[model samples]
Target: MAEGISSDYAVIELWKAVKSIKKDAQDVSVIEGNIPKVAEMVMEYILKNINYFVPINNNLVRPKTYPIDNDPMSVNWLFVLHTLNFSLWYPKGTKQWKVDGKKGYFGLCNAIRRAIEDGKPIWNPEYYTKMTKSELECILQSDDGEPEIPLIDERLRILHEVGEVLLQKYKGTFMECLKLSEYDADKLMKLLSMNSSHIGTK
Candidate 1:
């Protein structure tokens, strides 16, 4: 992500980092078949569904139940969701956390949807500023029961930070920020990355 490095070069560096970290971190044989299959499927999927850049479609991105037709509100909802989109790893041996039969990040999506459905003020920055642990717990409840999303405290802090920033600088809507970026992907990525450092810390 350094300045002057083309995306191709950044990808190469990322692959190198992955190779180095995974080399000693696990038994290579354990992931030998899995990694290749995963990579092949990812490549195939991307090639099959490649798309031209378009303005984000909030309806498509979020669960159907929490539809917010108002463009600014929809954008605010997406911003809230993205604020929690980091470090979803669970304990090594536990059942993978799931919601509505979806695992990993998809599961997280449903969990957020359910939280909103259950009336969590998911799109409101002022609500997040006063959110409590119990309230967050309610938001992260698993569909299968007895499991919870990891990093509740950290996620809560991030939520608050993102919400507060949206309120203060963008009139509580990330759509304003998006407009400031003129709908440019690079500008938006930089904006998000800069905000990431301040996540959960205001």
Candidate 2:
């Protein structure tokens, strides 16, 4: 859509950022040289204060928010959630995911890619964080209107295999990546949250 309007990114950015300031502003005839500089300025304005935008039309959508950018929680949440849902996905979380130690980050990062595509939240993986032991048991028992615990390792294994994608490949859109069952993911996150913290890595 932007390319159809003009040869320059600056002009496209100007149109996206502004309404009818005057025909002169749109004219671009007065501004000569440094078109890239202008575009860079516009991008800086946007990237620095992305929170200020409220898009005008269906043609415009905000870029995906990232963990490295303004909102750190989004990235951290998805990463953690991935770990909780499957131990095999990342090396950091639990032994459950080790899966012969052969399948690891590749799996986690891929899982992250899927979740980013889906726009679902990557929840905080530290299962015990903010949750009490009573909370944990209630979760385990399917209390508080949640699902029952997975006592079965096979189910956990499936989760482990799927969550292994998030560690590296899918960087820009962790929040949008696909999600596991909120109930199951939450339980695992809580469990890892409690147990995984003090340990050193292999």
Global lDDT of each model? 0.70, 0.40
Clashing pairs in 1: none
User: Taking the tens digit of each residue's C-alpha lDDT, what string does model 1 give over 1-202?
Assistant: 2223323445577799888877766655355769889999998886676663122343454455455576446777766776776655454445655678766566667887787778777778888878988888877777767567777888887777777888878887788889988999999989878876876452
Give candidate 2 misplaced runs (Cα > 4 Å): 1-66, 78-82, 85-103, 124-202
Off by more than 4 A, model 1 = 1-72, 197-202
Can you give the TM-score per candidate against the true fold?
0.63, 0.22
lDDT of 2 by residue, 133-169 (tens): 4443332232123223333244344333333333332
- Once model 2 is optimally superposed onto the true structure by TM-score, how far is the C-alpha of residue 178 displaced, in angstroms? 26
Name the lDDT value of residue 191 in candidate 2.
48
**Model 2 TM-score on a 0 to 1 scale:** 0.22
